[model samples]
Target: MKKLLSLFLMGLLVFVLAACTANENAGNETEQPDGEDTETAEKVLYLNNGQEPTSFDPPIGFDSVSWQALNNLMEGLTRLGKNHEPEAAIAENWDLSDDGKTYTFHIRENAKWSNGDDVTAGDFVFAWKRLLNPETGSPAAFLGYFIEGGEAFNNGEGSADDVAVKAVDEKTFEVTLISPQEYFLSVISNPAFFPVNEKVAAENPEWFAEAETFVGNGPFNLAEWEHDSHFIMEKNDQYWDAENVKLDKVHWAMVDDTNTEYQMFQAGDLDTSDVPADLSEQLFGEGKVEVVDQAGDYFYRFNVTKEPFQNENIRKAFAMAVDQQQIVDFVTKGQEKPAYGFVSYGFTDPSGNDFRETAGDLVKTDAEEAKKLLAQGMEEEGYDTLPEVTLTYSTSDAHKKIAETLQQMFKDNLGVEVQLANMEWNVFAEEQSALKFQLSRSSFLADYADPINFLENFQTGHSMNRTGWSNAEYDQLIQNAKNEADEAARYDMMYEAEKILMDEMPIIPIHFYNQVFMQNESVSGIVRHPVGYMELKWADKN
Candidate 1:
């Protein structure tokens, strides 16, 4: 299986993590039991989630904010271990057919959900079928398209009965794939593949909405969820491997501001926090910052259906105007690399070359070329003056600063004045998903370790492709890449697809992401997989 090292090795190789989760009235539960030293009775870690998790439902909580916490509270057939490779979790072991398109997983004999029900093979079948059901409306549904009939079912062209997954027996779960997926094991480690308890979910479809009803089968259990304020997780004694679990509890706060979070960290309320951009240099110079590697890019998308951006030349002009290098050096001021292509570094191709290096720079940055393109685009549209442009971003001091910098860059490089707008992450995410914004900042963390994971997002009508851009050829290339059994040929198709995406200019590359944060030295053993999300299972406080 491909390891998370495909995400690039910066410092620690262990998938390190820190505390997080919602707290309802678990306030009393976090208190120490009698006679134990109040300070030493329970090993508790407090951390921030930045904002409320979009949802707790396995398939529904697709974003990092939600998946990071869910990663601990729920167990998938496989889980990314401290080494960042998929290891057996609910499924004790699995076998692959000689064709490499079918997988049979063996469930653990002692595996039990938080509610004490067996983590059965039936649960996996039910959850996976739910994901492919067109009525579920899950954005993460596309991730499962590698499964046979998943695409047809999700696209409403087939029924759930057509999906090639089933419980062979109580302990045996089977899944057949449409093709040979290189990252199948790693991909299934994503929170979206976690099985939902069949009985609990059938009784209460809204079981994931609150702490009282959530029944997870991982290292931790949701003991309290007070919504936007905070949430709490207590260690699950029922976990199959609970004997090895370290942390007793985790408290996750939903504060979105980095500066405020840093202050709370300084005040000792938070065990860890993201380094404020202003303090990044100071912290790094003091040897206090940890540069966590991530396989993803922080970029911007242009809604091609919106005015001005509807012109390809205009979109390219705007994309070429902003210097990604300058933005990384001045605005983000971290250990991030400026992105020249959609895919970030460290994915080793079949021939053993980094995919990003192999693809080279697809995005352009020539100021003169940008100015000419802008003028030509305006002339072609017969506009006496270009339409007013607004750059939208979510609520983050970092996002705001980057937007301001981009606005200024447009003014200086192309002589185009642009307005800036910001909204809370939820509102911004919803608006962007609905194609309500012309130009907006966006980030993508690889759901799995593969170049195709990054390149597949621009396909026509894909949930990730909110830009309203469509190219039949590009879509076909992605489809071909997915089905191609030869790794070399598959990668070549992905390379071509990326080039086509850049040529269309529906998006601008900013910088590749790295999780730059500070963790108190006293905390240890948190596992943060580079594919995406953190695992608090092995975390310990002193």
Candidate 2:
């Protein structure tokens, strides 16, 4: 009986071991509800886009927020890379003429628009002509001025046929430049140069305003646009390199308030958001902040064509009254450098010296001089006291703080009563563009790593020159610099132009911008170019 019990126990032990092994194997083979064997789920990247994009039509969209969304939705001949260098996009390769004034691009056969239409060379020709057409009213039409005959066409001296872009074949596109611009390739990567589908645009001028009608040719397609709340973009299966794209979707929330956006980020509702200035110190201490030296300037422009501001003394007085050091140190929390000039510090001259350092301290605060100038300006305008002027800024905590500080400085040092006004980004941009305000906040991010980009805005009739301030000498200097072959001569001409700009004071230099933002550790492969562009084509949430 004892021997029989021992055999039974041994059999039971073997059976128990077999059952446990079978259960372990079954658990390892478990599948998702959809029967997919993948261990991870589809990834979606979330971000606070800062503001509602004014427009998605590439030619009409000029602000950073608009360009950010457009960059994901469209593909130009080239695209900005990690170092802000030009990388081939729709154009597979190109051949430069021996004279360096012409480029012949070979379009990729696999490139297709979101609607499954092949992106032909004719599309580029049509787009270039459309951008230069005065009737289009694209603020960025000046971007095409580098192409041969572009300026003449834009100025109504020539017809669209006179423009030097041509399509030799369905796959071959060519462009002739009026001059050899070293940064031409880099400039074309901007959204203004992206191709537009002639059929779609002609059929409906408002196509880009709606997600369903917007046909893009980039890594993502606009799936939904909820005006002030958020927008959703999904992977574009038709993109040429779609196979390599990592994230399945991207959600851009339009959150203007930095504090609220940061709160959402902390709650894992956002993958990235700009850090509020007040919280930068704490975030940096916690090793959660990323700072990048930006090639941009934050400044305010005077309506040079309008009352009071028409007098250069008033503009100069306002420029000198505000203490830039205080704004940078206290308001910005030392995240930015005090800008005494329009051009930021990241750019370098041909000799490798910093541009800002080269053009040192063109403007600075002087309470006494500012007071005297204010009195003189009012006296010239035939008023014992200065009239109440309104200062306008976009809706943001940082901007509000800066505007309030400037208001206080003007009242204290110059005895000027300045009213503060705040508007949403879209409205504020329109107000500035229409010259609807006395003084307004503005900023310029480098389109390319050249001082010319900063100075080009003030050219006569330039759309961005909202100040209506024109100087023939300034225009001529820029032209001379463009034509100059000697590096030293070009830089010398630029410096001279900058001096004239500073002395005239069409815009008040506030501070040079530094990119201050936060990103979660789970996000990877995001690219922030020094030129103030963010690219997320390769970003993954794993």
Candidate 3:
């Protein structure tokens, strides 16, 4: 919320050309009939996952680490194409009812999983029901609430049979939505909507737990997994368009530290790595880093049930104490714009205006005002001395640096000495989601290219709302937007909801997420979607 402060620290979609083949068989070994040496080399791409995937089960792996890999290992009815728009994948095409609430998809007859099982429309019905099944407790269930009766089923108010998804035939999948959604096609491209192998799952409930048991219909198949260490994906020759998948293997390492990952890249162990904050200046100066637009936010959440943060005024005070411009300029140094609002800059409204631009700044920087609010909050709590505050973050060199910067900023602006604590990502994520932290780091990558996707996270009981934050008016506004048929009216509802979310101060806006990385010259065709995910169908390495 603080727009400017003393520089204390520190920080696209990038479209690479698609390479059709490898470089002169660099790793080949063979003797031609004429005594010429010749052989083919494996086109392997090495990447760092930054952490272990939350889960391989499509519905359960809702975060970046898992979705990044899942996107390659599975396909939904529709998938994001190289242009960052949804295109037919497993479902060759679909017919939308004139009223627009019902959709009938025609699955490709040749689509097959790695195990050679034909992908059927029933798989979609099974996966969708599993996602909305209250017993499954899928965190991404909210993403499917667009479907008619989806919310009711997930809320335990209705049976799975109540959900409006059905396998009309072996190849026909039909779904009825609560209302017409402009982003439905794009949203389904998310991993939460990926179809599961119902046959494999029925025989082995834990089919997704190990490489041997895993099955995928995407461009790659899980070949090896070592839990927290690394995993490998080999090209799935059974894929519908396997000929287009250029990479032979994808090796993913769970390295949380960017500096270490960068070192690995320099050592040729990885093909690409995040530009470390310390080296951002150098890498950027050398023009090795490419910054691409992404739709999402990087922020911190306040657990409302926790002391100090329990007071709305105190939450606002803490938020106002942050100098986001300082964080991006010196700390992150990734050329990201400081975020003063919840929604990222993208989504064009029916009026043809950027949602973020039209919404304008929701909060401002005022050192005096922040201090006044802190005092008033303390008075409201009748505290002789405010309770201690702890700022928590998951393990990451960059996150730790940002947390430290926040610590100094709070001290400078509000005279609050906030302690710092951290844990590995998996543990930190679980604890935070359970509301075990007073204040912790959080991020939101758009599930679709729409403003509502950014605004829906704070709804009263949404799984993404880990801050113990609940606002009835905000929730109603979101619900109204979801049901509103008028495009102009829907945009208005989202704007109002976002404003209220910022006013309540359950979260502090830091900087919007972006596709900022340094890639190898030898690697190409790895498309980074503006929706903040990678497309490696055509990725290749020499």
Instruction: Identify the leading candidate in terms of TM-score.
Output: 1
Please give the lDDT score at residue 200 for candidate 1. 95
Worst 10 residues of 3 by lDDT: 6-15
Which structure is stronger by TM-score: 2 or 3? Answer: 3
Worst lDDT 10-window in candidate 2: 21-30
- Candidate 2: segments with Cα more than 4 A from true spot: 1-39
Model 3: CA > 4 A from native: 1-40
Clashes of each: 14, 0, 9
User: What TM-score would candidate 1 get against the native?
Assistant: 0.94
In candidate 2, what are the lDDT values of residues 1-542, reduced to their tens digit?
A: 97455435533443353344343123333334553312144466878788888799888887798988888899899988876789899999999999889999999999999999999999899889989999988888988998988999999999999899999999899999988888888999988889998778889989899786899999998877778878878788899989878987677889888889989887667888787778877887888888887788899999987878998888899999989999887888747889899878876788999878998999989989987887888889897666679999999888999999999999898877899999988888888889899899989888777888898888989988999899999999988988777888899899999999999999998988788888878799888876767777878877
User: Per-prediction TM-score, please?
Assistant: 0.94, 0.92, 0.93
